[model samples]
Target: MTVSRARLALGALILVAATAVLTYAATVNVYVQRLETRLDAFGEVADHPVFRRLLDVIGYVRRFYVEEVPLDQLLEGAVDGVLQSLDDPYTVYYDAEAYESFEISLTGEYEGIGVVVTTVDEYVVVQTPFPGSPGATTYPDNHDGVSPPGLRAGDRILEVDGVSVVGMPVERAASLIRGPRGTTVRLTVERPVEGAPPQVLYFTIRRQSIEIPTVQQADMVTPRIGYLWLTQFTPDTPGQVREALKRLRDQGARAIILDLRNNPGGDLSASVQVASQFVPAGPVVHVERRGGERETYSARGGGLGLPLVVLVNGGTASASEIVAGAIQDYGSGTLLGEQTFGKGSVQTVYTWEDRQGRAAVKVTTARYLTPKERSIHAVGLTPDVEVPGTPEQQGDPQRDPQLRRAIELLEQRLGG
Candidate 1:
């Protein structure tokens, strides 16, 4: 009886072992099948000589490269190369960090020293500083005995954190200057003084969370004329504009001067919404796609019905052009200042998840036309009144001829 019980126990143990082995074999077979399927897909591409050559190079590098190369880095380089081959400046690939920064820009908020910069003669020069920002604040005398505390417009940046920025792109220099809130960035600046040698200055500015105001200045130019300087068209722009218009109307303004000078345009929806405030019910702009499909965007009626004049310049672009074109086409307002920047193409952003986090592609999807079907891709919109806003007259309201002209036009319309 004892022998028979021991035999039963051994038989049960053998059965369990066999089942475990069979399960392991099945799992290995499934994994191998998946790998083989992937190889088959690769094989289809390998039939092409170009792809086969690329595969050969990758294999050779994996086997005999002097230093170890990450697979992700190599793949990213390949993707960038493919996009670069297209040679479209507007179409670009954004890596993880750049993608994050791009997203922040759309929101009109960022952590930085609160200065706007542009590339001038291969130098990153300060355009302006936000009000009450670190860049706007005046500092005490520097170690070199320079007295100025705040960054000034037209100040050419020489270095950031001791790294020379000569010939660096403005975008790259701006990225270096931006950091976490409350941190400090050391700037070496060269200020060009008339009738004197260029002044070399140093400043340590603290970074902060900056909320960029789309409407820079809004006030009554005259008792009957309102002036609104729109810096950009962001998501918050339409609401801000509505409030400004209402306040100006309450102040007895019968006309408006919409300043779009130096306004590198942003959100398209914001532009349409702002245009709807002035333009009567009609098609504002037309979007033409690659396949010849066209769509028209119209104004949402019930505007202020006030006489309006739009101010534009060489810096006005993208959605700014859209707004100006619509107003001009509808005869809702008169455009004043030099021709616009002529960026009439629209870009659509596409994002995707990858093993190395998220990446983005900004591709020019369509070209926009004015309501009259005029293509302004390379040819900008000529103003009804051609007035030049020189660099010297930029910040000086008293000397700004463009603003003076806009006020003249508005006053004439108001019979003031």
Candidate 2:
């Protein structure tokens, strides 16, 4: 009886080993088949020298490497290698954190320092600060608390939370600066000086929901004229504009100044919604895709029919350009200030991988044009009046002259 039991135990052990080996073999086969399919998709590149070199490197690492390699990391590295070969700054892979940020940015809702930033000459510069933003109420506090405390435009950020941003990529640096609402971030900034070390500035900012104050309203001259600054056409933009209009009307504003300066843009639908408020039923702007395909966007509603003037500048890009271009094309309002920031291409972001977090890619899908089919990409929308400044000439008052010009134009049209 003991001998029979031992034989059965040995047989069971052998069966278990066999099953394990078969399962591993099946998994390997499946991976191999998928790899083969991917290679087939690159059929035409079989003879390419660069392609062959990549394959050789991958094989060498897999076979002769001394340390164990994680398959997912290896695959990600390979994918990055492929994208790098494209040589396009706009075409690159987004890791998990970047993907999350990209998603939030598209929705136009995120918790951060509440500052829009852009890379300018190897340094990140503040584009605009949303109203009620931590930085807005914090750093620009004068002795009276009624005006700005000397922080001006074109300020270059040197550090965040005392960490140097020198060697970091602009995108990475931006991500670091942004965090959940209520978080505080101190910054060291160089005030666009000819040669000076960054000034040590501290800001204990409380992060809030950051609903993106797309529009701001003020009685420009009180009871006579008012100003409405539309930073972007976000999801909540229409309601904000409506609210501002109501406030402006309450203040007895006779003429209106609509500021679209430095607006980078937002949802296309939002642009249409905002534009609809100004013009009668008319086509505002047109969208042109690759291969000569086109579509037109028009206004369908009525709005405040006061003497109106729209302000624009060279930093007005994308959906901002759409609104400016539309107003200019339809003759709904006079465009003052400098020509717009030309970013006519529309992009679509999609998640490319599923891992611990999501990563995405934003691809330019189409080009936006005016109702007259005027290109607004490299060809910026020229304002009726131009404001010239090159940082050195105009200094910190880059858009002030332009704003003055718009206000003047609106006041004149209203016979004020």
Candidate 3:
């Protein structure tokens, strides 16, 4: 266990950080170590009653606890107790190893079964499997081993490799599912039915080097409409979009449909660069810090002015919302589909070390607004045209309600 000091600084409060792979970082043993020789490190605060009380509790636990408690366990408990006192979910800590895994997850590729997942209402649900990966039915493996029907949307993950993950955190569960290439992992899932009992399914999948492109799809949807499905705003995304657009233009596409559904934003810098590719020269987004300091990231000159339709949903958030919000503000595009996922706060990620090991934390550093100064922290962006989602839309692209509406709008614009 790689223990971490997730102690927070509120207006002011403090807490502890968590670790990875169901193996949460070092233990409360860290707290025990902190109080051992660092009591005087508190300076004048050591004389405070609250600090005195905490010292008393620590002393008693060290002296009378049955069967010798681990030194680092109580330290972790103190950190955890601090976490519960805070309200923001994004301001949590991660151990060094876990932090490494987190960085790997965002790069659009990894060694795993190649599926995107999320925890909704405590249920670990499969959002989708990367096409051509072992988790997707579209591709066959070279292993010549037993293969199960690929994963599907709404499949509730029950266990991983025989270990129950019923109550595990999303990141922990995901870590459990990912491993080295060519290795195999078993998954047990519950397939939900609309009006019938859910069916239990099992799969033994071989892990492979999974590459999830930031732009999942790019093609000509019609004689004049080019469609691009972006999964994230990465450093590589602007170039990818540039190429995709060039290809579509070669295919005689004059208009574009930019799909941003289910895009969890990444890299604030990348977001600005991406928006610059579409919107004309102007401020893309405005960010304000706690001290009232404000900064505006503007778009560069020379971008495509093609007729645009952006497909969004509850999963379109962060950097994606920034682009959509800007496009909507400038009347540069039509925002189609459902409302977006509201995540307007910016988090600053950093790392620190302790007597035990290193840890990382995501601290809420600033709040961002649209170009028109609309604060969308908890309130998401509403589309120009409202379209509700339907079941089984993932299996067939033509059946997607949002896409169908976008196509209709484009057809009308193109006079097709």
Candidate 4:
């Protein structure tokens, strides 16, 4: 019962294991084939009308066109064709150049006139300009007393170096104005005045190293009130604010005026970090989607012990809204200024392998909400005290009447 019996048992065990492994491999192959088949079927069914038209064009190229199109060329054409079909201005295909600009934007550095410009209802309008940049200086002489004709925060950029921006894509317009530092870019902008035609005002600005100041500090008329201006929620914005708060505290500031006027916003995590400095250990902002997925950002630890006043305006967007909304909802601060910009959607950038290999896709993945679960997507966040700036007034601290009101409110809180 020794050697032959043992060899037979071992052979039987090996045979069983090999059979199981083969079965598993077969099962996996079948599952993968089925999945691929289903995906192909779904893709055909979900082919948008535009995509179908693109497919028609591709068919024409494959059949009637002269030369054989390279596979890479065909893929790029297909990608561009897909985005063009949408007809939505926001939905766009970024070539290497535009994608590079986007990358620079994320790092908060770009070689431009330091202006964020976009088309709003067929007119090129100036979005928020980075502090100390050319755009901030380009304004009317009446506003803030910053001399020499410069573009204001809300001015319309009609032409770039005499090139008419009308009927041009925003990306093209942006590209035309943005270039290397020390280079001069002339902008023919339209000042928003009553009964004034789109004037040809030239701004020959030499671009410089535009380091965006996340936090600005000033002493109000009430000596006890220290005003802190938070432009955007950048990566180091929380630390900047903490340092500002410390300086304000050291200056014997009893009431704090947090100004968030015309801030188009930045990093979401930075907003949560800034908000965490104000609120107690509780939910600061809750991010949710249409499908019931949820994520809650909570305050870290201690709280700023002072009469807090948050100032917001039309440009206050995304993460700025998050901070402002949280402060207002928790009774931690009083909000002043105009309604916010209301860009509350969260996006995720992903690259996936398809039939054409890997392609980058950025899709709106989630919607943001206040601590009380109030969605501020299209509907902007309204302030407690509404103060709108006139066309004559457009800059910082001084140009914003709303910020002044915030200072006044903080002073009042300090019994000044």
Candidate 5:
């Protein structure tokens, strides 16, 4: 063969490849244009400034970037930026792995160290460790080291297995902490103390199947007065409440004390159902959406009609607020203890899958108002009788003034 013949074949190959590339680009352009046309039919979103800014960003990165970046990462960063610009903390973007783990968490069970955690600023802080879990048990005799074995409330988790988790999503940090039962995970935590230097603790905890209960405890605090402590709301909550009420009733109880202190809230539907068990059949909450659309979630079925006192604090949030707000508005229960945690925005979780994997977004689609038509977002519910105290003195009368006051009020109601 000749050099010219080889050169000609190479030129033809290059031409075909170039043609294929141009054709693919054209097809993508056509698809994007069609999408823009569709978007225009609804709200002229294609002409929006955000669309222009985003396209400019993509073009600049693709054409003039020095280092190569994966398309997925680049696109995901863009998606994250857009969501962040909404300036709403409730609206969040979760990647595939994080989203999968998040869905599991909603079921009220998982394989991990049993602790409720939340992100405060740049740290993932422990709300509380479940009773009887390793996180709750401190070393009886600390000859080796001290103050690090047992995780405490308000402890900021800085590292998981020595990898820094600071400034990351709560779900991401949680995923790092979770694993199959019998596996071990090391943690570096910063424990804050009042009027003293903070303590940094190290923990090597074995993972276990952690099942979080909706109703943490239910029993007769007095011979005829029942105390029900709820940790969170879930699908199983209403049933658990029913069972608890039955048990309390069988135990010969007439009055009740419902505790929502430190309850961080959960499923909205479950919250409404749980409210139904206490608030009687009436409007429990009103959801107000953009464009002035409103939805009323009413209590279903007959309530227990027992004289009630609902104990709440700053830890009480979201769905917990819904129940407390309704009970207060209907005069079905007297709210005591500290002010409630004001988290009244109703978030709607939307999940989708692409060629890459699954992703999800939790968007604040509406604001939830109490039955009395009060929005509690950041304003919290003021107790009928405000009493201030810490959770450290949970069961003691003198220590937990809130509990002491609740008892006093219930006694008065019973006495009357």
Candidate 6:
């Protein structure tokens, strides 16, 4: 082709591309303008300074930015910024992944290897492996073909699928480990051995639908005292507690020790049910909404009528606090431990969807109070018998001063 003809063709191509870009930009601007007008019809939202400024900034970025910006990302950032500005830690916006996990948590089930972890010394450490879970079967020596060795308690999670999680929070690490059932997640773990260097190990675990048990350990601590360690309040917690109580009663238990240590609370309804098991028929907790609205949760009759003592610590929060507070206020049980975590605000999870699939907004809807009308918001509940928890006495019940004290108290009550 002639040089002049070639130059003309290239100029035509450039013009067509520029025209297409301009047309697309105009279309987007028109769409946004229409949306703004429609939203303005609702109220003062469109005229609000913050809303106007956000739109202006977004428009500017779309027009003059060095690179193309995704509208979805900008919208998500705006949502996040608004939530952050509220300054309420409990009020949060959950993206698609987080929302899905939240729903799974409510159901008391999820697809994971079934290992409960905690952040300790800047490392994600396995606190416990659920029995029959892949983690429970995973051991250094056991080499089964079907369910290979899984995670062990005290194992330091170093990496997940080649990504370093050395200083990652346990929650984040747990989310990464959880996936659709039958999928595999590779983990690099470091296990400390007694009087030897730490051992590095690798494992590929297939995730499965794990049913989280709310009642962790239930047994007779003594001849007449039963110990029920409530892990967290879940949908099945009430049934589990009821069954445990029946078994304990059948075994000739006259007293009970309800352990709520390190338990981050869950379902509110479950908490009420558990508290009702020990307290007489009356108001267990009161939920007070904004503008002074209040709702009372009354306990149903049929309490075990057994002398009870509750164990709590700084980690006892939310729904757990509801149970502990009710028990304390009603004088149904003796509380023994440090002050509670003091999360007295009630959150209602609102789920919705947009172009970004599913999302959730967990907003603080009300402030709950004990039957005695005590709002333990920032100030936690002070135990009747104050006992401190120490890191050294974590696993060893013999060294657990708090447990020993509880047993002692129960023994005295039983005159044993």
Q: Which candidate number maximizes lDDT?
A: 5
Q: Count the backbone clashes (under 3 Å) in each candidate.
A: 1, 2, 21, 5, 0, 2
Best prediction by TM-score: 5
Across 105-125, the per-residue lDDT of candidate 1 in tens digits comes to 556689988776655555887
Model 5 agreement with the true structure over 234-314: per-residue lDDT tens digits: 677889998999999999889988988777787788888888988778899998989999999899778768889999876
Candidate 1 RMSD to the real structure? 14.0
Give, for candidate 5, the lowest lDDT window spanning 10 residues: 18-27
Instruction: Give the total clashing residue pairs for model 2.
Output: 2
User: How does model 5 score by TM-score?
Assistant: 0.77
- Candidate 1 wrongly placed segments (more than 4 Å): 1-48, 57-68, 113-174, 181-208, 302-304, 390-396
- In model 6, pairs of residues that clash are 138-149, 138-150
Q: List ranges where model 4 is wrong by over 4 Å.
A: 1-52, 61-91, 118-125, 139-159, 162-172, 188-204, 218-221, 351-360, 390-400
The model with the greater lDDT, 1 or 4, is 1
How would you encode candidate 6's per-residue C-alpha lDDT over 311-352 as one tens digit per residue? 887667778889999999989899998887777887765554
Give the per-residue Cα lDDT of candidate 5 at 65. 92
Cα error, candidate 5, residue 111 (Å): 1.2
lDDT of 3 at 125: 76
Q: Model 2: how far is 250 from its true place, Å?
A: 6.3
- Residue 97 C-alpha lDDT in model 2: 74
Scored by lDDT, model 3 comes in at 0.71
Residue 144 lDDT, candidate 1, scale 0-100 = 44
Residue 184, model 6: Cα distance from true site in angstroms: 11
lDDT of each: 0.71, 0.61, 0.71, 0.64, 0.72, 0.71
Model 2, residue pairs in steric clash:
181-207, 182-207
**Candidates 2 and 3: which is better by lDDT?**
3
Question: Which stretches in model 3 have alpha-carbon errors above 4 Å?
Answer: 1-48, 113-170, 181-207, 390-397
Error of 3 at 111 (Å): 2.6
Q: Model 4: how far is 281 from its true place, Å? A: 3.0
